[model samples]
Target: MKYIWIYAVIPVVYSIMFFSVRGGFLKSAHMLNIRFLSGLSIDDGSVRTALLVIFAANIAAAVITVTGHLGSTAEDGYLLREDYNGQTYTQNLELSISGEERPIEIEVAPRSYSETEKEAILSRAAMKIESIILEGQSAGHINQDLKLISSYEEMPIVISWVTDRPDILDWDGKICRGIPEEGTDVVLTASLEWGELEKEVTIPLTIFPKELTGDEALREKVNEAVSSSNNSEDEKLILPDKIDGKNVVWHSAGSGQGLIVLFAGLLFAALFMFSRIQNRDIQEAKRQEALLYDYPHLVNKLVLLLNAGMSMRAAFEKTAHDYRISLKNGGPKREGFDEIL
Candidate 1:
């Protein structure tokens, strides 16, 4: 009987009761000035149908969310359901984070908060802070120099911006009002995060600003300032720009000994190299003239050896030895006799 009530009786009876209801349940109850105990209202046939659909949908969603939260499903596989919330469209109801080995299934529903929820959220925030400290070490907000100041009434939240934005502090924080101590230069820690999400969060430091100064010292110093230009009558000279853009004082002098010495050194080096090259050229010409005379004699000897039916090697050797003897007799020398042969 319980199983029948659970499965068959509940569904059938619930549907029948819904169809047999007289007018709209909400309207009828409101007219009688009676309150209905149900969380959902079956105000009209269409509304009843919508509620039934919503109930089935919420049940399916709750089941899906609970299953995902339990991590009892394949990675490639996922369930789908209508959001039905007019504000939000039918997008994938999954929360994807980078470097996450598992795709996290968040319990997607209407965002609501309670005291218990707020506590849980606070605990989560604490965990996040701990994680940041663990990963960041001293590089995080452990050593930052920041100051915040505001009134005592509102416990002002301060947010520092290291971004390219014009302001040093972004719009995330507000100045608290009516502070007991006049706040000025309150010290706070700054943090910067980078990756899939760019999050810049500051860890609240144990420091606050010093009590505000009423600017009396500055006012007194300004009052005592000597504001007279009494030394303005001193003589001055106007200098002219030189042709080479140098402030060269006018003088009746030509080039100095330093310039002369430099010119002489340059001329001596150039003349010395040129003279050596000219001497080398004269020696080369004389050598070429001597070789020209020796060429004809050497050719005659070779012609005689060829007529005498001698081998080319023997002819060349005989000519080279004869040329050496002629050189010993103070005759003009032939070059590369051994090399040419």
Candidate 2:
């Protein structure tokens, strides 16, 4: 009979927690319910049934939440924000892939671009190639120094152009020949081959000529005279000795201390939870022990009432009434007598 009250209290407590509590407090109750249900022995059929009901309720709530059946008002409010007006909206909603199409086992060949797309791609590539060649030609033209240097080799030209079918596109290096003479244009040609698609671009280069005569000899004599003067000046230079200094050492602190602290914290938390569970079990055992200890006395009182010309129901009621009065008068509340009441 005492077990009936215990069973009734469990559901009542669960109801209050589910309806009244919110946020982390409610989440903690859910976790505790799951843990308690899992720890119950298989032989305890009544307790197991109660636990199953609570577990099922939690699962149903979770399902409703995930399926967007719950909290519809809050979702609608968030979606109606002013910032979302006239803008595309996206959400991280869960989707079921069960009905999606599956891949077939048949041998299917890879896809290639259509003819129109290939032509558009090739035209864009040609424009990019022409721009690069023109820039290279302007940069590579000899300056007043009359020396020729390939600008293409000095700085790598980055080609931002991409083809739809990169595997088929083949690019050959630009070809130019012969020294550029004064007043003559050097033509450089570049070729790109993709399958049957081919494109070629030609650019003309110009050279600026400067006469070379007695100026070379005069420049050499001036450079030699400047070198001799610099050497003599360098010989007269001096150095200073005896520099002051201080030596300091630094030691790095490792993560070992943090790891130790983390481990200690985890150990303390584990022990605390273990102690709480053990204390709860111990208290329950003490309660059951007290009930068993008072059972014989309660039965003896019931027998005395019955023997004094009282009916069975009257004797039971008298025993329960006396136990309640004693409990009210600061006596121990016997579980066995309370169950009878």
Candidate 3:
């Protein structure tokens, strides 16, 4: 009953508070509370919950004293998709933050996949990226990439595909844009191994650019795609908890909010554990009191056995065997055995 109240009340109250803020319940964009909720997400779990509360409090406290000049989005900042060869690419191509208007374009194309190119692709997946690398063929100023890539078709049909090319993959298996075939969604691969590495791995990744909205969903999708290709790299390098062994290291977003959510979740779990311990103690105490009630019946049975042609020693031994068997099979243990000796 106590546990029922704790789990039910805690999440319910938190959920109402969180959602009310999410839906702009009592605040507007100009208000500090609304701004704080925008940076939060419920699905990120409890660490995010704790971190979110702290982050919001911090932001709101600062807003009480600081100025916020950031606007939503600009007119030149629109969404567009480009196609190269047969694959399709979508990007949030935007103009520079400066007074200039020329958009920084992202062209989708298939280049030869190389060891250096894999490293380059992974680097582009990072937050601050300068250039993107293509797999399969060499990258050119769009001209050279297309020219050299077209030759792969003319050479020979070494491998044939049934659907869209791998480069133009949608979120699931759907191909957004690609050279279409009979069915859909096909990636014909003929890979050449390099170095002494016994296994070769292929990873799929989508690139997310910084837009005025700061779309985390888009970034997560792109991250998933890029991670698919990174499986060949084996375990990642362990990030140290301390720098010079003085204090714990920290990450801004991943470790920051994620850690907070984890800790909050632990609090709820600890509360649950305490409840279980208290309940267990109550049960054990009740069980001991119950033993006192069942004792006199055992005494009456023993008295009958001794009076009838049975010896006291034999009666006691027989009763012990029955009690042991009952205990092993989850039956009740005999009462008053403590007083027999």
Candidate 4:
């Protein structure tokens, strides 16, 4: 009931406000220029379109609100369950208990797998560990870090990793410092277990030093220096003045170079746009001058026709008809007389 009232009142109030802004009634649909409604009067088309939109929005809100609250009446400790299959089932649910203003969220899953099925799932997952341990690099020619996972998600299995050469490759698959220039060999062992079943998988990897460009190597040295300075207990923070063999220069975070570049770009764009606007205005002025070039002659002709006993309407038609004939015969266009026609 609360949800229904909240959703229902919102649409009703919105409809009232929308109509109130347009004279407090659904008499016209103003400011809505839909293409399909071009044939109908603007007011009539807008009124009908507004009513249809409001009706659809209110109906959708009501339906969604009502359906969402249908499961609100579920009791504590009650959860819907799926039929048993080979795979595990889990669902996240939010429960509202009596006298509690906030809902309690919990996860529910059905554990109906047999011992035989569990062992088979774990065995397959353990086999996949060796293929993925290299993390896309070839095992015989590895130069990057490995992706040693603590667990496999396909089955209920916990994995623990151990490396024989811990100095070259840590248990977490990170390549530690001091990798030799000629490369070395390392072995990674993964212990996989599910319930009482346990299996071990070993992967042999040849690790070479991670190749770094000049800039990357310099960046690493600077980062190391900055990290080393972080633990100093000196009164003022000391920054590194040199990295490797190159002299280092420290600049404040608020550098003006970026702002200067941005201002220059904006200035160029503004000048270009201003020039375009000036050209447009100049062209419009010339067009207006051309439109009024023969204005005095037209007025004189109109006055003479009037003095010669022709009606004002007849004089205008005659002038318009003559202009049309002239136009068809490749005469220069006069927009002022075209508007009169």
The prediction achieving the highest TM-score against the true structure is 4
Off by over 4 Å in 3: 1-255, 309-311, 321-341
| Cα-based lDDT for every prediction | 0.47, 0.51, 0.45, 0.74
lDDT tens string, model 2, 142-247? 3222122223222222223222222222122222222235434444445544456655545444543322358754454445445544555475622212112223
- Candidate 4 positional error at 184, Å: 1.8
Q: Per-residue lDDT tens digits of candidate 3, residues 149-225?
A: 21132322122112134354432323242223332322322222223212222333332221223464444544554
- Give a tens-digit lDDT track for model 4, residues 156-274: 67899999998998887887766888788998889998778898888888888776678867777777888786766766767788776678888878878999999999999999999
Flag regions of model 2 displaced more than 4 Å. 1-17, 20-112, 136-183, 207-341
Poorly placed runs, candidate 1 (over 4 Å): 1-256, 335-341
Q: Candidate order by lDDT, highest to lowest?
A: 4, 2, 1, 3
TM-score of each: 0.23, 0.25, 0.22, 0.39
Model 2 global lDDT (CA atoms, 0 to 1): 0.51
Better of 1 and 2 by TM-score: 2
Which residue ranges in model 4 land beyond 4 Å of their true spot?
A: 1-111, 212-216, 223-245, 252-341
Give the TM-score (vs. native) of candidate 3: 0.22
Clashing pairs in 2: none
